[model samples]
Target: MKKVLIVGGVAGGASTATRLRRLNENLEIVLLEKGQHVSFANCGLPYHISGVIENRESLLVQTPEKLKKRFNIDVRINSEVISVDSSNKKVVIRNNGEEYTETFDYLVLAPGAKPLVPPIEGIHGNNIYTLRNVTDLDKIMEKLKEKSIKDAIVIGGGFIGIEAAENLQEKGVNTTIIEAAPSILVPFDSEISNLLEVELMSNGVNLLTNNKVIKFEEKNERVVISLENGNKVEGDMVILAIGVTPDTNFLKNSGINLGERGHILVNDSLETNIKDIYALGDAILVKHFVTGQDVSIALAGPANRQGRIVADNIMKKGKTYKGSFGTSVIKVFSLTGASTGLNERSIKVLGKKYEKMYLHPNDHANYYPGATPISIKLLYEKESKKVLGAQAVGVKGADKFIDVIATVLKFRGTIEDLSELDLAYAPPYSSAKSPVNMSGFIGENIEDNLVEQIFVENLKDFDKDKNIILDVREEFEVVVGQFEHSINIPLGQLRERYNELPKDKEIWAYCAVGLRGYIAYRFLTSLGYKVKNIAGGFKSKLKI
Candidate 1:
């Protein structure tokens, strides 16, 4: 019988074992997990800390007893894989100070990731916590129950940090999120981040951006966090969620090839450099679908898929990993933030040729009672018009929109496909045209030369130069708000007032949304003038 020894047991390892058992019933499968629980929802940790998941047992997806009985797989908890001798096809496991060597025909390494605890002074204090495993959650939960942790300081405003802060706030704790970057959720664009920031602020959660936590100091039973800007924050507890790195310390001398970020290097077949050895989940560095670069994505979705792929390959089937778009979504207060593929920041870093468009449309029809605005941003190749990525932020259905875009990106779908998508729609659920379809409409215009556009960031460059910034909204709308250098010329009067406008200088047209600006662009372009529609229009500008 083929012996498959799996290291670690969570999303990746557990999935691999279960699938492998279904594939080859006679195979000798053994799962070794360092933690007490073999399978649990690590993503649901924040919600559990907030008391939203009142029962701790709810986090346990499957206990060792359940897994063993259901799958007939040997499951050992608290058994850490100390080292792997790939040449000998053996794994050194240490349990309760007793060591054992297990030989395997195929070895799967899913050690997962470790929280990045920066070398800040007093970081090892009792009040500081890092949430990665069940033990971490247990520690935090115990502290919350025994001590009066009325205030919390979460370092790093990524998904975990934001979620942790929100959950702590739900538990009546005054939470503060300190992000090193200029915004929370670094994966998203500035406009989405701005909206999320507003949402967090409105929820009584203090958000501090452009700030770095230098160190933590314990004074008089209070934890004081020192920021780079000479600001100090006192909190009852601190959560370190800056980021995570692959947990490959045990493989230091195990002869497994690691990538630049210390993640295990594997090929399309999920096979490591060592013979008969495989790596998956956060421990393995996989390809980024859009960028075509080996990048580490620690998301659970990709990890689960990688596990399945590894299992298929182990079954002697020709299966390969197609790479990941890094599609992800998170809920912040009332808004849901989601993104897929690359954003402007990534495109700029890669120096790739790309065009972007932002559209502010209601999640559903305006006539719908609870319709909320969804800000959608799409990035596409300027030459090919291929949809590269998209980001959406709104109260409802943001993730659904991102899901559609992610599917389109998977097939290398272009802007034209988006326009022609036969999407299901209704007044209560969606507009006559879905937001994805609207995004396609805008992308199609840019592709067909029907409109020329400039981004909000480029507005500063043209501000100094002489240009006719036309606002296509009504006078009443302009009275309520307008850009500083903008002139109110409603779309209805633009045809008659064309002669009064300067034909020599550039004309940048904008309205409430990009729809009216697109209308103005076609009109001015037909009038034989140098014109560019302000992509995303006034609403986006206001948010930015």
Candidate 2:
């Protein structure tokens, strides 16, 4: 019988062990976990703290006792694998101060990652937490029970930081987020992140952008965090959510090829350098879905998928990992934001030529009673026309649109494929033309050279000496807000008042959204007038 020893028992290891057992009934499988709980939903920790989850036991997926009873696998908790001896195919395991060596015919490493704790002064003080596992959650919850927390300082503006801040605020803590970057959610385009930033501010989050914490000081039973920007923020508690590094330090001399970020380098089959050895999850580097570059997304979904692939490959199933798409979504107050594939920041770094179009469409038919506006951005290669990425923000259905586009991106589908998708439509759910399809329609127009469009970022530096900015929205819409030095000319009145405009000057037409501006552009362009539609429309992009 072939004995398989798997280290770590969270999402990656647990899934791999369970699936592998099902594949081979006679294979001896032993799962080792350093943590007290074998499988638990770490992502739900923040929600539990906010009383949203309401039950602590609900987080447990399959405990070690349950796994042993059901799968007949040797499941051990508090058994930490200390070192690997590839020469004899053995691993040193430590449990309750006792050490033992275990030999295996095949080994899998799914140790996952550890949260990064910035080396700042006084960081080791009381109640400073980094929630990565069940133990961390228990420790933080224990502190909250001991004393009332007045305020919390969350370092880093990524997913964990934002979620923790939101949940902590819900628990009556005056929350603040300090991000070193210029903005939060570094994965998304910074320009597109503007909507989320505004939403955070309006919801009473004290966000300190472009700031770094240099040191921490404890005084009068409180923590004083000093920033590199010469500002000090005093809070009762602190949570370090900067990010995480792969938990593969023990594999340093284990003959494993690690990436630049210390992630175990594995091929498409999730096999390491050594034979009969495999690694997956946050600790392994996977190819980027769009870029095909080695990257560590460190997300739960990718980790689970990699686990299944590892199991299949071990059984000679030959299932390969396509790549990590990095498709993810987050809820901020009433708004939800989602994205997939590579953003402009990443595409530009690779010097890839790509074009983008923006649309502000309702989640459902506008005539529908509970329709909400959704902002969608689509990016595609200028030459190949392949869909590169998308970002969306709205109260409803933002995730659905992004998920639909993400599926198309997985197949290297082009902008035309997006428009051709047979999506379901109804007044309560979607429109005759879904927001995603509308984005495709506009993308097709751009791809086909049917419309000339300019982005707002370029419009600032545009040559104001000649090109005119024209607003094509209704007069009432302009009264609320208008572009600088823009001429108000409704699209409906453009045909009758064609004689009022200069014929030789270039015109830039923009409406509330891009629809009316596109109409005005098509109308004026056919009349021998050089015209361009400002992308994303005015009111939607400018935050009405």
lDDT to native, each model? 0.89, 0.88
| TM values, all candidates | 0.97, 0.98
The reply for model 2, stretches above 4 Å from the true place, is: 540-544
> What are the per-residue Cα lDDT tens digits for candidate 2 across 1-544?
9999999988999999999989999989999998899999988888887889889899999987899888888999999988898878999999999999999999999999999876788888876889898788888777777565788889989988988888887887899999999889977787677789888888888999899899988877778999997889998888899999988888887887888879999888999989889999989889998999988888889889888988898899999999988999988888999999988888999999999888888999999799999888889999998999999999999999999989999899998888889999999999999887787899889877779998776667666778889998889998788778799988889999977888778898899889999988888888989989899888445432
- lDDT tens readout by residue for model 1, 1-544: 9999999998999999999999888999999999898999999999998888989888899888988898989999999998888888898899998999999999999999999998888899869999998889999998888557789899989999999999999888999999999888978988878888899999999999999888889987779999999999999898999999988989988889987778899999999988788899989888999878988899999989888989999988979998998999999988899999998899999988998999988988999799899988899998888998999899898998999999999999999999998988889888998898888888887777888897666677775366878899988898777877887888999899988888888998899878998888888888888889888888787354
Model 1 collision count: 0
Please report the candidate that would top TM-score against the real structure. Answer: 2
Residue 112 CA displacement from its true place in model 2, Å: 0.2
Cα deviation in Å at residue 219, candidate 2?
Answer: 1.4
